[model samples]
Target: MADKLDHLLSDYFRGKLDVAIQLRQMELTYRHGTPDENIGGGRKQNDYNNVVESRMIHEQNDPELKRLRYQKSVIKMMFDCLIKSHQDVLIDKYGNKKGWVTIGMDNHIDERTARE
Candidate 1:
């Protein structure tokens, strides 16, 4: 049962990856930021003080430093796939069969622009 569950979960996630699932993950990270990797939310206000103080006092880099960088390209590519998929949405309630941004937009998708 466990193996079967894992397989289903993996398959579901892979299917979502065809479009903007990456974008969704990025947004989730920005809002709640998983404990496993704070990259989900970027840096918080408290982190700034601590990291900056440590850097100045220690005069050395910090682990938080490496995690500070945003995976911009990866995020954008994910958004692009999502945008492309949206183009095929035949209905509102029923969109992508099994799938799922910037300053943090949805690939900066603009329906008014008439492009998905």
Candidate 2:
């Protein structure tokens, strides 16, 4: 039988990379800023650009980065609680997105064993 925590942790691990990527993209948007150079109006154009840029930098509505960080910390705590073998397998499978075959080869074990 599969433990519920194991399943949740596995899912969390798989999503970790994607969450990190999203956070990075958000940060990049903040750093690079929203370009609105071709605004035909004068003060309105500048105001609009400033508003957009401020919103992006503030990220008031989106707590995704913070949530991802919390999730990552939870995943890390779960990993620390797991046994060495389980930790190795999960880290290889999820962290590096490695296949069972690669994990097996790396660990000097059969692919089937790695899969288990």
Q: Which candidate ranks first by lDDT, i.e. highest?
A: 2
Error of model 2, residue 104, in angstroms: 2.0
- Candidate 2 lDDT over 1-116, as tens digits, reads 45765555566776754667476656756566557676676555334547567756666445665565566677778779988887888878866778899999998889999988
What candidate 2 gets wrong by more than 4 Å, as runs, is 1-62
For model 1, the local distance difference test gives 0.38
CA-lDDT, candidates in order:
0.38, 0.70
Give the TM-scores of the predictions, in the order they appear. 0.18, 0.44
Which residue runs does candidate 1 get wrong by more than 4 Å? 1-51, 55-60, 63-73, 77-82, 86-116
In terms of lDDT, model 2 sits at 0.70
> For residues 6-95, what per-residue lDDT tens digits would candidate 1 score against the true structure?
443343334533334344434433453335556666756554536445434432233332222233344345546665445333212123
Model 2 earns a TM-score of 0.44
